[model samples]
Target: MAYFTNFKMMMLFTLFTLTSNAVFATEVPETNKSNKPIPEATKFVTQHKGTFNGKNLNYKVVAGETYLLDKNEQPTASIFSFDYLVGDEKNNRPVTFIWNGGPGSSSNWLHMGGYGPKRVVVPSDAAHPGTAPYELQEAPETILDITDMVFVDPVGTGYSRALGETESKAFWGLNEDASSIADFIAQWLTKENRWNAPIFLLGESYGTTRAAAVSKVLMDKHLINVNGIIFVSQALDYQGSSPYVDDNIVSYITYIPTMAATAWYHQKVDTSGSFEAFIDASRQFAVDELLPALFKGNTLSTAERARIVEGLQRYTGLSKQYIERVDLRINAFRFAKELLREDGIAIGLLDGRYKIDERDDVSADPKTDAAKVISPAYKAALMHYMRTDLNIQWQRKYLNPSDPALSSNWRWRTAPDGVSWEPKYVNTAPDLSYALRSNPQLKVMVASGYYDMVTPFFDAEYTLNRHGINAEKIDYYYYEGGHMMYVHEPARVSLLTDTRNFIKEQLAQNSEK
Candidate 1:
């Protein structure tokens, strides 16, 4: 996944020329060949029965690879997917394609923690999940009863890999990634003869970015219309989420309400007021007061600046002096470190409920993320489940977070045509708007976590508010946890229920249409 400039490519070519002749002079050793023929695609199927939402459910799991082909129809890459089809009602049942973010991540997180039938049990209150023998259980809250689910792994993730002479980097950019995934979806629908089935997409974090772009691809390139899209911990607009940048005004405005919610959670802010009311106040202050003061820059009057600083202090639970020193713009990372400095603990950016005790307190950013405390348990659980329960026996390693090379080589290009490509903060809201316009029946459900600083709930609202999106077609749901909000049992059940309801409503509406 190494991204190389023209200069680097030329240098590598020259180095290869200098060394190739000498290296190839040695006699090559011959290897034995097996007569066994290689299969074009890998597939493993298993069946199971379970009770969900008071109904006995029977489902089949198809864990395998689907090859993505080039223009010549030669295999380019093997994209891995776990398809869970419920009952024999395949043609009419809704099908939801799900994946997590990271640009390089596999579908493991959402597969194991969110809506899959099998889930890893982690402490709900953001405590450190130590070592293994992690509890893995059947999640009755899964949406499998309402819709079939397919968890897909992109190229260079999970057991997916480049095939033939194709390079893995071919599917590493924004447009390339979306197009390949759309192709996989199209291939899957055709193979299963489920093209008439309602199609929904569920994506988390950067996967949300992919979902928006992929929706457009499906409509324009493949002539496939999406029924709905679900965004879990949405990050459709990077500029709003990236609070680290000093000059990102939208980031500052979008993050204030989340900081206020975090402060309320920690009991640092006054608890006498209702949480919802406090959040509304914070939102108002951000747009009406804070944003104006920030726009004024040095032109702001001393009294006005003082008023804004006081408002920030009250909302963020930081001292007025501290807010003034930072010029009223709170960097999320710094806030994580400074929030509970007196208690010798730093808050997590993903989940502010979790705290970490860094060795040194003076660091600008927290040493580690508190939300990652439960990651080991998740990894162990997924590996064990895949082998023991799902019975997926593969020699290749299952990459959890991602392959380093894939991420490093990932291209950030989002341009649709031959426009001058300049890498900037990725925003796919316009793509989503286009999808909505093209597909009138399409609806979107956005799930946000109160404690998720990485993609603040406010940012989700802001990103969806404009961009020509119909307000009636969108629904918002909020949880009491972090980015991977489903790790919390209550939130998990709530999310599943809300999503199921949304799907049912969408189907009913589509039927009437």
Candidate 2:
């Protein structure tokens, strides 16, 4: 089995991907291809450049070798970084360190999909749940304009390879991952000579968790502090976000509000009486009635519990029987398939808005398969466009939305007895009080999609509230989309505008001080 290596070219191509919509402001259709080439221009190309979606751009279309060094400088694991420098290098612009989740996922999706130089073209009616000749188009709003981005794929993902099993496992644990990514950031900055530039960590899904841990590690361990951190659909404190146990009912409580919002957007639920009124009412019910009722446990009378379940089913689109059996607590998986089970369809896990009635008909897992169905089309279009139009190519495997190794156990530093003790809940919230006590310049912004089911916006909001970030400075934005919100043109343009504004503000604030 390959450990982790050769990711430069693969990581470079992550110029677009999945999640929330309505935040992006770019509405142009395949208007341009990226102008940046994959690094190591000579690595995999016979031609100097090519076209991507009829747009002129740069590309490094071949695999450029990267070596991983250990203590005393021994080759540890082979790894790489996809370098897409935004702005003029002569000026030494700020840089954003970007990544995706899945303890094992490569940063490709986030790189390409959300803030990258290239983005996928989604129809206006993105929530319709259909497929298309999806393609990657030039993205003018790539966070690149303000910050040069280095997208990374950890060991075992993309083209990263370790020396052997022993060295490989070194990168497989939680602490290991933190150390590895922190080290990578240090090394990348040194190699790129951008140590003087502001550093920001941007992550999605598990990457959100990764960013949180990395933020701490970078501070305490690496001593390299970042200017700002962006948690896209941030996911931290797994116990609060995931439904792993019975009391996991808390996860459902946070998710209900988000589900209602998405349903309202698609007109799947009754919003005739005023959508805000409806969601506000639901939120109130959740905070007041549902959460209290669930907390009471068996204390509630049978009729009371029944009434709560009825409300939950009505709002969540789940069956009353199923809701009752699970005590009104259901995870994303159940909702992904069961919500529309009568329609005989399972929704796409990556993008909840996508749906497939029959797995056999699609030849892929309802959750995973739908990604495959749409990804190839988008990817193929991306490859061709980036190579031909952008004229950039570093021949390494492009990180797809799917990677098997992502399922590996990377959360580590477990005790000898197999008891892992990471401060499950930081007794003190990770807010300005915690992170900014030493550095008040640190302000946090959370970009979320209201329709997102994976890391529901409400859950993220709840988590942030727990962190003690000042409600005033803590900025939150919601797109009318799910996980990878920029898939739609409207969202993409709006998100870009928001990103640009945020970066400008950060820079202005830094300078003013």
Candidate 3:
């Protein structure tokens, strides 16, 4: 939801305590008894034709339990691969592996609302649209109409997790993550034997790095081969990524426009010019004028500071007095509460556009990705699907990650580290570089949300550019979305439209090849 924009820190914090503290469902051992080479997939033909929020929902995928086994032939982790029959399961069109970004998030958001068979309803709160109605209707907008979509959860996020006493390390690290996914792909392909089906990767947040890493693991491990990869709010690396430093001043720099956009919706920004024009000018000033001045480190004259304050006030829709009061360093929380605190209103961090006039505007944390305004319907729907639709009922906590009660802070940390590289051990940076060279035809698309503070657009861009993906060969589109673009209905439609067009191009190009 809107909270996903600043999900990086929150997700990491949540991950550390999710499994035990979080109240989501938990995975159990698969119900099938197969002591063979590759355990047979729990094949079942079913349809989810439910209706909610006055809309119809539908799906016709082979919903079943997919498994990956060690040499001893015991169940490791369980996954549900939603196979949409392009023609027949035999025709072999193309298979796209889809996942959510959080190292802790499940694929439900992307699977349900993005390009899956169902979507959660947006609530009425203008500041934060939630599933107040608790409706999970069918989403015909699913890309399954074209490409076969397989939603995956990294090892711990969704139903795809190890059982009690199972080695959790089998699912950790860059290489481990890729190989686990690669193993799943290979087993699925062999179980299904659609060897000719071209593979594409779609990952959001950390999953983007997962996709990049996995493409190589697949090649080296002789696993799945990927054609194109899509990164949604990706973070390839985090060095010099965020401008939101020094408490809140620098964060205010980037978080301001988001604030401005929210303010504009409330008719608060300087009404002197059109919204887009106002935004463009403000962005330019921030990047060109303000940034240089701040980097000066006190070399700036008093007159210059006044000018910067003037521009910040004009663009941020705050009282010039308040702008000066903070010494030009208003953090996002203060900005959210103080910006409209007089009206007894508190804006939602997920989508700054939504506000609630409830209570005193006091925040527990300056940077909060609280799902308070998030729709619970998708979470509920995924739970239901796991039981009724897909029929996996181990149930402890559905989407809980490693842990959450600990003090977890997501800092730049370090490059994925020397401790672990999953699936098959390979250096991440060098491996990605080599694989791209091995198949220069592979193109990457890094999807970023401008308002996403979690995996800032700048960092995602920086990481990919570091990989040296040619600008010409890569497609980068900035959406006015938070982590999950679908949080705003308009953005959802726009993203789907863009995604469909991109897929159509791939299809066209595939035909020529």
Residues 221-252, candidate 3, lDDT per residue (tens digit)? 87455677777766555332333345423444
Highest lDDT among the candidates is held by which one?
Answer: 1
Candidate that scores best on TM-score: 1
Report every candidate's CA lDDT: 0.82, 0.59, 0.59
The TM-score-based order of candidates, best leading, equals: 1, 2, 3
Task: List TM-scores for all candidates, in order.
Answer: 0.92, 0.78, 0.77
Instruction: State each candidate's clash count.
Output: 1, 76, 33
Candidate 3: stretches off by over 4 Å: 1-44, 47-59, 71-75, 124-133, 163-165, 223-225, 239-244, 247-257, 319-330, 357-371, 385-397, 400-438, 446-451, 456-467, 478-480
Q: Model 1 off-target regions past 4 Å?
A: 1-39, 415-419
Which has the higher lDDT value, candidate number 1 or candidate number 3?
Answer: 1
- Ranking of predictions according to lDDT: 1, 2, 3
Name the runs in model 2 displaced over 4 angstroms: 1-68, 86-90, 127-134, 164-166, 318-322, 359-372, 381-406, 412-434
User: Model 3, residue 494: displacement in angstroms?
Assistant: 1.9
